[model samples]
Target chain A: MILIEGKDITLGYEGQGIISGLSFSVEDGDYLCIVGENGSGKSTFVKTVLGLVEPLKGTISYRGGLKKNEIGYLPQQSGIQRDFPSSVLEVVLSGCLNRRKRLFGYTADEKKKALLELERLGMNRERNASFQELSGGQQQRVLLARALMATEKLIFLDEPVTGLDPKTSSELYEIVDELNRGGITIMMVTHDIHPALNDARTILHLSQGRYFFGSKEEYFRSDLGRMFMKEAGHDHH
Target chain B: MIITEILSYPFLVRALLVGILVSVSASLLGVSLVLRRFSMIGDGLSHVGFGALGVAAFLSLPPMAVTVPVVIAAAVVLLHLSSRRKGGGDSAIALISSSALAIGVIAVSAAGVNTDLNAFLFGSILSVSRSDAVVSLLISAVTLFSYSVFYHQIYATTFDPAFATATGIKTERYTALLSLLTALVIVVGMRILGSLLISSLIIFPSAVAMKLGKSYLSVSLIAAAESLIAFVLGFVSSYVFSLPTGASIVLVHLIIFALSVCLRHSIIVFRSHREMI
Candidate 1:
């Protein structure tokens, strides 16, 4: 089923449209990676999908319209976000903030769920540690764990492995693959083309308000893919 | 020695109570401001509070009555302008903060109300009235209650605004509400801490607490405790030594911040040495 459908959307901030006349759809259990150069509206598209920025001229329909407590998300990490004074546990528990009882605090079951999510991500030992003290890879995993606390399905990750070492990135991708196997649809925005080409079933190449969305094999065979490969100095295989 | 004597006085007790109330609320709001990188907005709003005080004095109205609404109005305008700007949130805050401070100073000067600039510049904790204490208490209670109730949403919004919106949290409403609450705290705190020193009361304690505390809740609580201690000590020091209450309070808070920084560095060094061994 189509979980998210954006039709001919145009989005931007304060009347300046960044991307226009774009359309896309995502189904349940699909792992789609959006790739483009910097300033190519990759992040903007992610924001639009997340409803952070309203589309100026089109409709974005959610099949099972997202619930207030559903839809886990991992935003792009930046230096500023790293210094936020929160523990790993507290950050993860925030996923369940919407679910907490109004007058009462976080219930035992909610705390258990947060802990369980952290454990699943192999961050149980670091739950008590400050978020800033963690390494970049560890921070990303903790954020992922936090997102997981909300729901197991329809996770939107913005550049999940942007600055990590190869080993850590591979491990993180393996975790993404694991989540996908568990029936979680993942929509990730990324710049690196190689690893994603290898892992993602679908690749959506966006640029200047235009996009080429297709299966990975079809993308590699398309004219835009050929142009991208030539520009990046990769031989067409 | 002086602490006991200061505690014995009813007015001093009232000052301390007012300080505690404002400190807690400001500390809570400080977390959001620091995270958002709009810490200077506190300073700007406090200056607006000073201008409002001037207006109040001129009109023979209670300073808080005028200050609260005016500061809140200024905050709303600032929030709106920042949202509409393309220079990003912190830059927008900086732009509005400086302009507001300049206008506020001008307004105060133009009013020519014979109010001591030092009282507004530095805080005069000893002068807190019964009504000021009551207002401070009410603001603190409301701030804490609302914060606790909306803790999750606020946390999510602060940490990742985009993700928070995706999760169906109304980021705009909460952001505006936070700005409004911050304005209220600034106005209420202005009576004891004064306009010039109030922002430091909001910021320094939180910075120190963030360095020491393990969690957000712990950090906020520790900040409140530290601010309370600083307020009492500052009040006492002022009473005994005749020092400026605002400067003394700020100094105590800064001392705590310096101590926390030193402690953090020492721990890092010790950990590194242990790792090497």
Candidate 2:
């Protein structure tokens, strides 16, 4: 049931390695939350898996009949990307672009699916609203809906709740948890590690030069885990 | 009757035809360029086209043919420079634009083509030959067709290039294709809008449309319509007032852009007032 496997991957940009010798495997229906301090290359790892960046070393393979394009991805939004001129519906529908084989346009079914995903994200009312005009939480939800249109099998979310209030962040996590419960594999990199670790079956704690990849309980007992928990202040809330 | 008499002139008819066609193409592609903050690229490529036109005139060769490939080459170079370095887009554009303009000025002086230079820089719509009109029509058609066929991909890339690439779109190829098409459009369009003002045709309509339209598709359509209206009005006004055609078209776009901004502000104010009531 291994959906994706990465071994000794050294992810980086422009011939320089950011995080080296990182190995991880994502199983079908598994919720893996990647946690780390800043500059631990959490986003880099996500990009490598999504094929946006190649590993400077090692291998990444997709099993379980998963195509690279079939893996939905929600990238971390920059300020410029947030101000992109597009509507909520158009943004979501564009996710289906990778799924298409033809060059004409989105099919009726694709449009319906995009609409449905918007509704599912509780954004149907804002479907025609400009994406730039949306609040941070709403923008993340729209992006999630876009990822949904890309694939139902697996999703990779990079700090989906980076700039939201605590309440909105928890609500976003609830949606992600629901997605996991519905049999989708999730690999999310998050700064809010406590809630993520609570819902995640697997915890990946990446630090400089090394990483820990195991079940949640095993992660709690590791030295890196103790350090992280201490730094994150051991409150399981 | 006077309008019909004016339209009866072959040169004027050709100018209008080519002008409208170029406007539509420029506006459609403008949305993508402006949204991506690469609007100045059109200006840069047009300058390159101006330089190529000067070189062609110096050599007694066909200007459009030389201009098209030269602008395309410049586009490719700019694309490469921008991609190779971070925050290089504007710098690359500035470098190419200034260099091209300098080369053009020198070429015009060296070849004593000041009259031809003025026509290319400011645009003499009355000078649009039959052959030039045919080429302009064909290039405009290709630009529009390419935009139509790759509309979705362009949309994805323009909105978020990294996400588009992650979703298995060949973003680089599509971006390069867009640059080439923009180059072609600018080269052909320089005949009507002039190199100095051609980028305005690509920048103004899109900027104006974004203020009024809610989505990319709607904005593109609005931009094209705005470009057409501006072009026709500008052409007519220039004919009546005996003004420079290219500057006249750009002036019309500026007025329309101002109007769109006012209209958008008025709607917001009206909605807020109603809410207060």
For each candidate, how many residue pairs have backbone atoms clashing (under 3 Å)? 0, 0
Q: Residue B163 lDDT in model 1?
A: 67
Question: lDDT tens digits, residues B1-277, model 1?
Answer: 6667767889988888778878878888888877776677788788778777766665668676777888999888766665564747566656666665666566567768576667876767777888778878888999989988887778778888766777777888899889999999998887777787899978988899888887777887888888888877776777778888888888888888899999989988999999999
List the pairs of residues colliding in candidate 1.
none
Which 10 successive residues of model 2 chain A have the least lDDT summed?
A77-86
CA error at residue B203 for candidate 1, angstroms: 1.3
Q: Interface RMSD of the predictions, in order shown? A: 2.5, 1.7
**How many angstroms is the interface RMSD of candidate 2?**
1.7
Q: Which candidate leads the pack in TM-score?
A: 2
Best lDDT goes to which candidate?
2
List each candidate's DockQ score. Answer: 0.54, 0.69
Task: Estimate TM-scores for all models.
Answer: 0.90, 0.96
Residue by residue across A86-192, what tens digits does model 2's lDDT show?
88999999998986877797888999999999988899999999999999889999999999999989989888887789999999899999989999999898888
